[model samples]
Target: MNGMTRIEFLLRLTISNPDVHTAIIGTLNPDHLKTNIAAVAAGPLPTELYTEISDRLAKFSQPK
Candidate 1:
């Protein structure tokens, strides 16, 4: 997944799980780090997008 998708996935995972306190992401490049920060600043994914992602993931679990 792209950086933004990965970030949103991480944020969504944390938001879904109350037990999760924090998510630690590592990046050495300044630009990537800045982008990651921006992603966090953008806040949680919208409900529609979150549901879409969840649906997509759910498909993977179904018997094929």
Candidate 2:
């Protein structure tokens, strides 16, 4: 999935705000899309952190 897309942000936002109920039924559908992205933000754990940590440990091997 393209991380830069609004859809990705919307999906993440929805997951984060599951309790924000709305009277507008259509707004809750999976097809609902966000054009303005003032609310969506990247998650707390950046994806690059995991990759960097894994790369740093690539040389370590446990004894058999």
Question: Which structure among the candidates has the greatest lDDT?
Answer: 1
User: Over the stretch 1-64, how does candidate 2's per-residue lDDT look in tens digits?
Assistant: 3454655444444534435554232355444434322224454224564345445656575345
Q: What TM-score would you give candidate 2 relative to the actual structure? A: 0.25
By TM-score, how accurate is candidate 1? 0.61
Clashes of each: 0, 0
Write the residue-wise lDDT of candidate 1 on 1-64 in tens digits: 3345766667655565445677888889999888777777777666676677679888999998
- Per-candidate TM equals 0.61, 0.25
Candidate RMSDs in Å, in order, are 4.0, 12.7
Off by over 4 Å in 1: 1-21
Q: Report lDDT (CA) for all predictions.
A: 0.70, 0.43
Error of 2 at 20 (Å): 5.4
